[model samples]
Target: MCASACYEIGCALGDAPTRGTLALMLAGLLWYVGFIVVASILVSFGAVDSTRRPGYRRRDGKQEGTLMWPSLVMTAVVAASFAASHYSLT
Candidate 1:
């Protein structure tokens, strides 16, 4: 649903985003789903120790870097599109 909103915003922006931005958004969504799976697997296992186990803390910085900018960019694109449209109608 959120992904759809991003794509719809892209459409309204006249597809101004580069193909790479779209691809990153798709990849981010996939990676987020994969992260959920990993977290579930860890919860299901009773043997893993927190300190000894692999942690997303290692990737947290990179993940945030990739995720935040695109979301902000997309939201801005949507809001700007709506603003432009509203102004054009008047």
Candidate 2:
């Protein structure tokens, strides 16, 4: 996904963007948007909820629940995307 966006941006900076490049850019944008939409759908459908800390177990009698993984994944995704969008070699 990142590669698609990067290539799209790089192509856009050229003198005259070709049809192929334009298609690539469109595809990249679609892929990026698709990911976000799918992710949101997954979250709403409880894909994220499954990763959330489970309820207390009644064997050794310990109540330990933490929503660390979901938080971390979300944070990392956002951070990586932000960095990619703002990245440059200027």
Best by lDDT: 2
Model 2 clashing residue pairs (backbone): none
Cα-based RMSD of candidate 1: 12.0
lDDT of 2 at 87: 56
Q: On residues 1-90, what C-alpha lDDT tens digit does candidate 1 reach at each position? A: 334434444454444367765565455445435544554554454234333434534554332223445446645654564454334321
Residue 40 of model 1, lDDT score: 57
Model 2 spans with C-alpha error above 4 angstroms: 1-16, 46-90
Clashing pairs in 1: none
Q: Whole-model lDDT for model 1 versus the true structure?
A: 0.45
Instruction: List, residue by residue over 5-84, the lDDT tens digit for candidate 2.
Output: 55555555453347765565555556556666755665664654444354544356553334545646765775576465
Worst 10 residues of 1 by lDDT: 61-70
Worst 10 residues of 2 by lDDT: 81-90
Give candidate 1 misplaced runs (Cα > 4 Å).
1-16, 47-90
